[model samples]
Target: MRAFHNTVLRFAACIAMMLLASFVPAAALAQEKTSALMTPELLEKVRRANNECFACHSEEGVKKPPRADLDITKLRPLAHDPKVFNGSNHGLMECTQCHGQGYTEFPHAADARESISACEECHAAKVLRIEKQLDASVHATRVKDKFTCSTCHDPHVDLIASTLIDPRKIVAQDNQHCLDCHDSELEFAKFAPDDEQTSTKKKRPDIDKIHEWLPNTRVHWQAVRCVECHTPATKTLSHEIVNKEKAERQCLTCHSASSSLTTRLYRHLAKEEQERLGFANSVILASSYVLGATRHPWLDRLIVGAFAAMLLGLLIHGLARIVARIVRRKKNHG
Candidate 1:
């Protein structure tokens, strides 16, 4: 009997171990893979190389060209804020990994430019998904070849908004991408030029005048991303941008109790809060107070209960006053 009990316990332990091993690999595979960090020795070498590159590539350095003979018009602005890059998703990477080792020496080799990596080279999975989305976007239909990732995203300083904690910060970062093209006439004309037959010079529509119908436009701009209205309401973090005419304009779409913001702008926050607190719209309540949108069941019940108690108290006081008046009248008559 003792031997049989020990055998049963051992079998159960083996079953538990097998189940854990099966689930562990599935969980690991679900997470996105990042670039491996360099060894300490290699990291120190990369740091020294980055410092040398930054000497000429920094914001102040870009203002003064290294060679007077070089054509200024041909040189693209390579200036970037090191502090911003350090806080970005690509912060751990070595500059040479993207720019090439030839940059270590002045006057880079003719083939060094060819060595520069494309976003898709390292981010095959993510870029593949974005490519599909871009294919369906209005920009793709209008400017077939001109629209690329860098058109909206500045690789040097772009931070993943989903990783951020503050919703306002995410809104600002995402909106800046849209505003960079839509708000700037020069940028807009690159892809969305006016009809040459009608107008000699390209002119972008006034963004403020276009959005005059929206109430508190400045507040809405600060609180939500442009994509919240531009993209399909069904998609979360969608890159398929709709045209201005097709953009969402209904106030109830975002201002109602069942606001689409929960699935769109605040999707990440809602998902996080749902996992942690079991409340879907708690994120909006915690972040910003939106009228008609930030409703809580518990708070609603409390308000209704208070109103009912007040009405009941008023009715009781009226009845007591009538009974006291009758008693006084009866006593005086007797």
Candidate 2:
């Protein structure tokens, strides 16, 4: 019986040793991989591809005097700053993830099927909302060829919206996006062809001259988004932009007791009654003020009321003086 017990114990020990041996290789392999990091060859390949792609896609790459006859808008070079791109949310992702294969070589083959990724592929929900807004917008209905995501946003240079530290900078950036096409005579001419005109170029509006009615127009443009005036009042803000003529130019739209900026641009900033009203809060008022939106609500009313009272007092005093003068003349004539 003792001999049988010893044999069983030896068998159990052998099984335990076998199990320990089995785990050793996997643990060692994991350690090796962690220590080695990225292979030199792989790093070189990535660097080569980035260099090749940027050569043409970058401002430094493609020389302008782009062919007028050919639709070179897509081919035209818009410089991408590497520092900005690196700081963005999509920075770490490989270029091939969006642009896809065949971009490995320079002067991508003319016939090469460009496999660009769609925004909806990853952000289906956000894209759905934006698409609804776009479908209803004048741009989609009026223009022969509707604008795409790239028309407004450049994937390479555009920083993550949340990453923007300065509110004023964001406002300027937003306005610049509209000005990019609208202010350019070439871009405007492309949008509206002047078949009768010899130049085919349309006269672009001087933004400053057009917005003269707006106090400190250039400063306002740099502080507030164009969409604040262009988009209609809605529960959720969107890109359903209107024509400039249709835009809410009334100063009261933003300066009155019922301003839309609180609901739109300042939505996430402003806080009231324990509820975060807008993006940052009234703290942003330190940087730039939107008349009704940023100011203390009661303080605004107090100022307006005091001004009105003073005006009434002045009018009453003038009327009383005139009446006294009239009475004296009547008495004297009598």
Candidate 3:
């Protein structure tokens, strides 16, 4: 019985050893494959190849001379700064990722635009959401030539969202994107070459001049987002941007107890927190307030009534004093 037990233990040991040995080759194969694909030399070769493509597309590449008929502003559109491109969010991605498969060769195929990948290819959900909003935007409904994602954003030069976290800075950047086309004389000409309504010489409104009625116009623009005024009042931030003319511009729109800024600007704050920091609280916390955001309806009416009563009392007192003075003067003259 002891010898039989020893033999059974030896057999179990042998089985375990065989299983361990079987996994060794598989692990080695996976390591070998990973090393082959991700060697330092391979990475260097990729960097070199990418630089070659940038040479033509970037500022260092051949600068194309402006055609006799071509507008000067249009000429620089093709030129890029390689340093800027490499620093962008898509910097590490290969040129072929968007340019397409055959674009690696010189004098690339004539149909390269067909090969370029749509932004929706990778950002399906985000693109879909923005598309729905954009479709319903004033830009889409009013303009004959509707704007696309590329119209406002340059994929090659635009920075990642993670890098633009400051609310004030973000607003300024977004507003600048709008001004780029809307403010550009050349852009206007391109949009409507034949139409006299959109004359190339016509300049965009001066930000301060147009918004002079708003107190501290420049400061407000810098501190607050253009979308805060331009977009229709909504809780969710989206691409449904309205034209300047349709924007909610009434002082009461923001100053009233039901200010949109209360919800939109301070949206990160919890409902309880917003309530805790009522109208005066918002002013105390942020040095700003929308007049009605925290106002009590009864209190507001009481204050208005009190002010009116005081003014009426003063008017009656002044009239009585004036009559008394005049009567005295008439008696003395008589």
Best by lDDT: 1
Point out where model 3 deviates above 4 Å: 1-49, 62-75, 144-146, 160-162, 192-209, 251-334
Error of 2 at 54 (Å): 3.4
By descending TM-score, how would the candidates be arranged? 1, 2, 3
Measured with C-alpha atoms, the lDDT of residue 34 in candidate 1 is 24
After superposition, candidate 2 runs with Cα above 4 Å error: 1-52, 55-79, 144-146, 193-203, 271-281, 297-334
Candidate 1 residue-wise lDDT, 1-334, digit = tens: 8535544554454444334333432222223212233356754664576666666677655677665654444444776666666555454455765675446566778777765656665565778887877898888876768877888887666656555557787788889998888899878877774465985545777888998998888998989888888887665577889888888888888877788888877776666555224333667867777777776666678899999999999999999999999999999999
Residue-level lDDT of model 2, residues 1-334, one tens digit each, is 8534543553453344334323433233221211133355653564466655565555554554332343346655545654455444344344655554445454555644544556665455778888878877766765638488778877665643334545575686677788997788777666663445585544667777787888887788777888888887788677788877778877887775466666776665445323234422354465666665555656657899999999999999999999999999999999
Q: Which ten residues in a row have the lowest lDDT in candidate 3?
A: 26-35
Can you rank all candidates by lDDT, best first? 1, 2, 3
Q: For residues 1-334, write the lDDT of model 3, one tens digit per residue.
A: 8535543554453344334333433333221211233346754664577777766665545454322443335335566676666544454445665666447675567775666666766555788878878877866775537466777777666653324434454556667777776667667445433335764444545655677877877777766667778777765766788776777778776666556654665454324344432333353135343345556566667899999999999999999999999999999999
Candidate 2's TM-score = 0.63
- Candidate 1 vs candidate 3, lDDT winner: 1
Give me candidate 3's TM-score against the actual structure: 0.57
> Which candidate should be chosen as best, given TM-score against the real structure?
1
